[model samples]
Target: MAPHTHIKSVHTLSPIDPWWKRNLVTYHPTPKKSRHIKVPWWSRKCAAALQAKRHAFAAWRKNPTPPLRQRFHYLEAQCKRVILDEKRLAWASFCASLSFSISVSQAWSFFRKMVHPQPPLTFQ
Candidate 1:
């Protein structure tokens, strides 16, 4: 095996290059007039009133209604109980269905054996 030698070269960009001219020096047009326009007073007042109404509604919602909360909690608990009951019922139904299928298969095998009896052979 022989030893390998590697060489590297460095490249420099020129000032007169098209890339330098395009990137380093670019022209942008000045705005002829100001872009910002003043909002009308009526619109501002309406926006303020809408904001106030939203704040009032938010405050109203933040103060919890005790009766409503109690009712909601009660209903939620009932729903949980119902869901548990439904799961138990579903498991029972599944067990019943599995037992019924097993019984049906056994009954079918017995009926097939009874209907088709094998003949006996006698040798001389």
Candidate 2:
């Protein structure tokens, strides 16, 4: 058996080829054009309402109860419940916003496809 020799060479080029060509890979990222779609007024209103409710509950919890700390504990529990409900409402509003964005994107894509379509080609 003979000893194997390793060769290292580097080439410098004027203009570099695109990443896809150099790496021999193609990547198509999801289009972000949907961000242009405006969110619904109702969704914004609901989110605002939930935020306000959460803030109000927090304010209510700030006041100290009398010598009976048990009452304060109960109020704290109530505050926690209110906060949880607000979080739920906020989550629902967020989901609504996401759905609205998805629908808008679908509609836009359909419209684009209708306007300009790829032509079919035949090979000899």
Please name the candidate that would achieve the greatest TM-score relative to the true structure.
Answer: 1
Lowest lDDT block of 10, candidate 1: 115-124
Checking candidate 2 for backbone clashes, the offending pairs are none
TM value for model 1: 0.30
Tens digit of per-residue lDDT, candidate 2, span 1-124? 3322331211232234344334332353334653232322224334444455545556556754453355545655664465456446645664565654477776565445333322112110
Give Cα distance to truth, residue 11, candidate 2, Å: 54
TM-score of each: 0.30, 0.28
Tens-place lDDT digits, model 1, residues 58-99:
554677677655655555455445434544554555456565
lDDT of each: 0.42, 0.43
Candidate 1 stretches with Cα past 4 Å from truth are 1-63, 99-124
